[model samples]
Target: MVPDDLLLETRDLTKDFGGFLAVKHVDLRVRRGAIHALIGPNGAGKTTVFNLLTRFLSPTSGSIWFEGRDITRARPAQVARQGVVRSFQISAVFPSLTALENIRVALQRARGGTFRFWRSDRVLEGLDGRALSLLADVGLEDQRDVAAVELPYGQKRALELATTLALEPSLLLLDEPTQGMGHEDVGRVAELIRRAAAGRTVLMVEHNLPVVAGLCDTITVLQRGSILAEGSYAEVSRDPRVLEAYIGAQA
Candidate 1:
């Protein structure tokens, strides 16, 4: 069980695009070292919430606290520097580069340098070694030299994970990390995500209910830009409103 002390909390979080409200007032929390799943139908304000967290879209009027700091108005880079980062559904990898090279670039970005010493092959090798170790940790060491674009679909996803892990984030915001894959691939990615969940908090927006049931300690259901229900899988699944909006035969 995750401790009650929060790692992320959104108080009346909201987002408006010109006059249309993309996301309504939202109150959410993610605890340290917990796999919290956010599930909802298409256009259910899931992505909007992620954008707000990452500061991609400024909230209209609300507060966002991360690791106990108010960051509702932080810039995207500022938020990333604070260890709040998200993984994209589409691979954000450098497809032209080898897996090791991709991770090397991310490592330098994480540590805040890559172009400092031009002639130091030793430093480059050190960076390569660290990237290799991280790739190995993500079970992608065998493909270290393989170009990211040439990898299979699942492998591309894995590469994306490696790049994100290189950021060493305190909280991971994953948007459909297992989207566009087969059942076997889904299970594999789920396992990989579980492996990556050590020592950090993870929050995901997933439509796969089985994945949510298998991995989430708590699930929040959203509909029409508001949280419809939230609780244990069984608890929320049994709620009449959730059933009607997202859990019944139609759901």
Candidate 2:
């Protein structure tokens, strides 16, 4: 049985791609309402773990439990419907759509409305207030009418985050949220994430150690497809093995 404080749990999770074992016997537990980070060097299978959690890829072994319910066999849509939503490493938004329009579309989907582009404009207008609020939450209110493709790269990522927030996920999975950005944009997005995580749980695979240290409540370090250390930033940062496997490798 999963503990009451745990929002998500994986037991001995493993993934095998033919002869290559990408992830092996991993146990992950994300506490409710905590910002947890998974950090690792290249090919340490951080993204693979995210894929398995989101049901984008099937796990070769082990079980996934969310809110104490086994979700190992759940379909991707089913998992999403249950409020486990993920954002990719790459920014994902409608390139041709205006920022407001993009957010409105996400609102429609979240509210279970079918996509009906031909619907009366008035029908969609009902969602504008909420969409605008979300845009403001991400500091993109001024760009509401700007096309996503035309927005600067940082703003584009912020827009993508807004759309993801529309889903109102209980457990939000962010993959490399600050993968490509300047220092200023990184700080902005980091603040946005902190605000967005107020009432929800976040599990992220992040490469930026400073962001992970500042934002994550718990950090899990992976190396060669296995967990090398799991603890607070202070604890794990002092671990000699973690230093050698992840921090040292990066240096």
Which candidate tops TM-score?
A: 2
Per-residue C-alpha lDDT of model 1 across residues 106-179, encoded as one tens digit per residue: 77776655567755646556688789888887678999999999999888888888888888898989999999
Model 2's TM-score against the true structure: 0.96
Worst 10 residues of 2 by lDDT: 110-119
| Clash tally, candidates in order | 0, 0
Worst 10 residues of 1 by lDDT: 112-121
Q: Could you give candidate 2's per-residue lDDT for residues 180-249 as a string of tens digits?
A: 8999999999999999999999999999999999999899999988999999999999999999988889
| Cα-based lDDT for every prediction | 0.86, 0.93
RMSD list, candidates in order? 2.1, 1.6
lDDT at residue 234 of model 1 (Cα atoms): 90
Measured against the true structure, the TM-scores of the candidates, in listed sequence, are 0.93, 0.96
